[model samples]
Target: MNINLLKLDFKNIRDFRELTIPLFKEKDVNTPFHISLIQMPNGTGKTTAINLLRSIVCGEILEKEIVLSYQPTRYKCDEGYFGVLLIIDRDLYSLGMHFDYRNGVMKYETSRPKEVGGGKSFSYDLPPYIRNVMTKNFTRLFVFDGEFSENILDNKKTEAETSIKFLYFLDRLELLKIKADTLLENKRKSTKDTKVHTQQGLTKLETEEKKLKQTLVDLNKQLKKFKEESVSTSQEIEDLEKKNDELLSENETIQAEFIEFTTKISSLENDIRNGTNIILNILRTPSQFSLKMNDKLKNLSENMSKLKLPRSVSSEFFKELSDEDECICGRPILNDSIKKKILEKAEQYLAADHITTTNCIKGSIRNMDDYKELSNLRDNLYSYINEKQQLIQAKDLLKLRLDEKDQEKAEKIKQEIIRLSSNLVDLNLYIQSLETKNSAFQEEFSLNEYENINLCQKKLIEKRKRLDEASDTVNFSNGVSLFKKMMDNIISSSIDKIKEDLISKSNTRISQLMGNKDVVLEKIEGCIYVDGKKGVSQGQSLAVAYAFLSTLFEDSPHKVPFIVDSPVGSLDLKVRREVSDLIPKLFAQLIVFIISSERNGFVEGIGKYEDVQFLTIYKDERETGSIAFHTDKKFFMQFHSENEEVQV
Candidate 1:
């Protein structure tokens, strides 16, 4: 699958009243220019263009506020339009979004190839494969801005993992598993409701399953809402603290003490957060945290080794022997008593499924390290708790001093802070309770199985098994289970391979970009991280991000255009040149939104390519619209914004 950008059109949107910029060369619609550089100054529609491109490709629903934000500022406009023309594997398509500012409504329109004669439709009419692959998350990978560089490195974000899953079709495999589950469910529903007692059992189980499913859904929604509220509340608290600091700036004596306490409290809070993360990571491996579990696992492993639990001969061997005409000692097994005895003894050995499970457990236990880490884990947990206690004390002392200086204002702020803090604590505790898995020591924490996703899923599976047995669809259920397991194994191995390859390729490119700088990509779990570094400069971050994304898209089956805003604006001269030279070769088409400030080294490097198109667009000072000038490299390099403002 190949997607090439041909042109973009805008009307009554942002700074552009009417505009069209060709993304390809003259007399070419089938093939896009290798490099199409569009230079736009600050206050122009560069950001709006990027957003519209993403919306068109992914068919995202526009919020009411977002739709109104695109209205033209120069004059009254009732509506606006943004359209994108592209070719997907030789088929021409045009996607358009019409925004009604009055009603806060946005409608989509799609035009297919002339051969199909499907004039215009008020919906996205893309092919199934294209729709499936061009998800919002995937679209953001190609159509993005410099902020994405920071997002790719943030540990809380899953941008790197999501890109791999979507680009490599692992998400599709997951969807197939979901479909299998749905099919099995339909089979259960279609079973004959013959016996009243058995039907009642199935009904009860189905009702319980539905209730559990709804509970899971509600819990997920609450989790998302709480997370959003957490971020907003934290920001609000920070803003209020800054305001308090400004109020205290009038009194030097008190201000100095306040600043000192604030700084220490902030430091302690950060330390607590980091410590909590570390403890959570340790808890993910329960055996490393509990001595009792460690000893039990070790004992189990040793006993399995001694007893040869899986055994050298399985029950299948005995069953085959029972079917033989004679015994191994040359005795006549034609005797019915001898065959019956052999068959009866076969039940004593492990079946194939049991053997496989035993082997897996044995391997897992054998691979675990000795219980030395338990002590270290305990120490870490203690240190984290100590830090948390210190943080609370510091916050309380700060409030006390604030109350001494200004009672009325400080009292109000302190009360608000306390309320917010309590809310945050409750949210955090609930989130942890919902996310934690069941363990042997769950009772110690009074963990409820119904509140936890993992435990609820386990109960759901058990109920499903009972229903399957009642419906006499055990064979079908087993087949679906096996298929799901196979898919899981394939997806896991594929992701592992992709992660290994991406890390190697990204590090190679990072080295090339950084030269002698010791920037090595150490891992790509939820996000990309550098070796032995807490953070990198903005330039280095951008370089690392480009390296990662270029490698990610290099071998993908879909050849989508790389459309980026300020691709090299944050980069230094050397990194800008490196990125410019490397990025064009990794994608089918490159459409970069740049301001005049990024033209020093980036334009020179990219201009070296033969198939490059340069164009400049900006707001017209005398008119109520914008102007698009089809220019050469000379004009593009020299042009500057009239206001001399730099786009961030």
Candidate 2:
């Protein structure tokens, strides 16, 4: 598996957006490392660097490359909530933590810019259960532990509740069945929910002139029948409900067709690999403009090199010659005329040429390659703009056509009013039976009714909760907030339970890994804490964090690179030994940031690992950037030299 790095030049950052920008530029390393350790003293801007890398992996922001910027306030505080994203081989992803303060409200997004647009992208914003795959996918996220651990214990119940939905999400078949069941129940209940009232059917009135009109001939007979028997308004209301259902069904069918076509278009877009979009623009554009400009500049330089005249054109002799010469074409050429035409022209040409203008290449600056690249980028933006406009227009036109058809359909129903009224009554009683046949018309692929049904199920529960607390007074105030709170409770309860289980299990593993340490996890109002009452140093805290993090990568999907700034901060020999093994055990590539004094034993432990790599970063006298001292790891092949410090 090839590793992609998000490198920062450090000199170009202009703003906070740059911190959460992107880096896809890559370089080859001989190392088979899955982890890259970086050490930058407090002032080195490490946090700003990684966050920018995260935005690129997330793909939530930025267009193509990282734009060095610092104006976070200018983009609006809410805009800074975006994160950086970095992509790895296979389907691995890395996203930077994003935090933005807006007015009095603070917003935190789940994933950064680069990782967005996936159907799974929303998983980041969704409650915990929805974000499991993301949480579990990357192997090294486990290595990161901050004060947030305190929140986990503090909100165990809340965490568990959030985790429950994730449990359900994992069970796709169960979720599917639940969705179908909910839809079936909803359809069954709706049949009974509708009621209609009418004093009587339009009492068909017929005149003596009805006999002349065949259509009205039956009107009087129908009116006489209504007087003979009163039609039940309850049943008529039921018929109206059935008619409502039919209309709803038709609407659903139309929506389904639209969605099907939309999906087809999406598939087609992917198949073309963006060729359809840029093909026309690329074909129309030419790079000759740039090349021709370069040629003109070269010619100008050649002319300037040989532009000087002879040094011996004496004024006395030239004057005498001009006066003595006869003008064969017309008259004696005057000395003043000679000076006016030839000397003046030469003088102006020499004076007009500024040193800078003459010395500088007169060619247009854009190279052929630059023009080609810009042309392609411009075409892509233009095509997307044009395509979106077309789609919007088409959607509007389709809506208009559908509206027109709907009006026409309503009018058609008017002509058969009597017959429709009779038929609607029968449909009220027959809806349940007709709906049973829906299962028999299943398509080859599963229908997406589950999404609609799930929505209805949520709404139904909400309505039921309100109805239960329905006030006796007819003018009772609506309980929308109460219903919302109830829903929030249900959702919270489900996830909290799962979060609790994860923390508990993960902590259990951490304790086991610690072996003889007596560190306890603390609980607070909002966060879970790992505190060592018996003097826990900052270095110890980092080690504890590493221990806690290892459990997270037990069976991770992506073999991410593990990076530790200071792996054995304040640990004793024993803790370092365990950490040495743990880092390599958890990640495919391990990079340990050491302070030179802590190298021998740590390197020995990792040297046995298959693809481990290491390097030491220190100031160099000759090089502008930090020099890297390479070790045996293959990744540092570029920096490897016989001399210990090769100024690399």
Candidate 3:
């Protein structure tokens, strides 16, 4: 069965309106090129789309869980719905999940293949086989994000075991083996003629043994769960501690800036104070003192105009005028009396020595020009005072904002850091206690299980001995025991063979994808090995994970599409290319969800393929909804080649 259509109606889902994607088209079929690339920037509903698909797959076994799991802050009482439309045997069947939180339980329904004449019937019950195929276990194998990718790189033993079970359906074989064992035991119980009491005793011992074995399994499962929870909690604590340290560092930097701003504000205040004093002193004296100095200079100019002859002009010029027969104004001065009058007027002028002394005194007097200097000083002081006040105001405003805004914010972050640190301590202590408890439980369970098995074996031996002494024939019990042993051996050997084959195929895929790395992966007993050693680099581990997945799907009868988000984000440039090159060839229909940051390397690695489909998911500028549709390849190529920031 291959899924071709995924439709999402957000008439119900909060913050999301509608989404749909036709992953495959009938015409563009090409070998190893059935690639659908969706380039979504961060927060453009990429994770939401992934979750919707995950929920659709998980809805097979889970009821209300798929809907409740996506309860974001934006979620409201709205009807959200998702559908997975598949083509099974060239007939269309649609599986849908309708989630209405307001109504309580989510609804799951699917349609059978349409009748040849063209009618459809929808039912709540999915076919058992189809339901089994869409299990949550392999959901991670197909749909995964960065965290699971990192888990792959971690190469967890549990992850490997799950992969093996799903890859080859080993669990079904184990169930069959168990059924065969039960059948053989029932046959042994059916022997009627001889050793009836021994048979009853043996049956009772076997029942007790089965109960003890089941108890052991349950105990182991609980211990495994506890350990997993402890690991997860410890990781959370580590993350919180790291975040707390970062917050502390950020708070320190903000405080340092606050101090620097406070210093500047103080300096500005000092400058403003000094400027104010200087301007005040100038204002106190400018009006009255400037007027007096101007009035004195005006009086001195009038007195100088009144002065005659010797000081203002030379005495020799007056003597020349007296010697003249006529006055200088053309009046005749023939008589001595007229000449004497002119001479008397001239004589009233100061002597040359007095004139020189008067000029020297004028020069010595304080100049009124000092008022210009005083005026300029006053004006400059006022301007300086104004500028200083502006600077002070700016600094004070910034200080006010910092005190009102940044200080409170930083203080809140500091408090959060403290809270997170305390939580980390508590979480670590809880994890430690859980681990200790799990350890004790594991020890006790192992001892009890061992004792129970030993007792069961002894009781069986005694029953067999009694039957042998009471009668001559123990053939019926022996034959049944031998048949059960054969089934156990077959089951064990088959599991071993499956593991061996998976390891070999995984190695081949690793070589195909990363041959130049000179790394070999082997499964020794149940542990993974790298080049016959126990450890591998993160890149090698991720490569091995991809290799294992490729091998699993290659042999799987169900051709489920691979939908991976940011699968190659953690790899170096070289390994990213290697993995990208191997992706298209590995899966029949591959949907590669990638962000723009990783596009360049992926494009280079994917090289050129004509049949590749490209879809870009972005926010609708006019509406509060996400939109995704097939786009021109060159658009993304230009976006990457020009290194433009994607505005999604």
RMSD per candidate (Å) reads: 37.7, 35.4, 46.4
- Model 3 clash tally? 1
Residue 364 in candidate 2, Cα distance off native in Å: 82
User: Would you list the clashing residue pairs of candidate 1?
Assistant: none
User: CA lDDT of each candidate?
Assistant: 0.78, 0.41, 0.60
Q: Measured by C-alpha RMSD in angstroms, how accurate is candidate 1?
A: 37.7
Give candidate 3's error at residue 405 in angstroms. 99
Whole-model lDDT, candidate 3? 0.60
Question: Per-residue lDDT for 300-379 in model 1, tens only?
Answer: 99999899788867898889999999888887788878888998999999988889999999999989855445466557
In model 2, the worst 10-residue window by lDDT is 196-205
C-alpha TM-scores of all predictions: 0.52, 0.32, 0.48
| Candidate 2 residue spans exceeding 4 A from truth | 1-32, 39-45, 60-479, 511-525, 529-544, 547-564, 567-584, 587-610, 623-648
Q: Which stretches of candidate 3 lie above 4 Å from their native place?
A: 1-11, 26-33, 58-65, 69-77, 115-121, 124-129, 146-156, 176-491, 509-517, 524-528, 532-541, 626-630, 634-648
User: How many collisions per candidate?
Assistant: 0, 62, 1
Reference-based lDDT, residue 240, model 1: 70
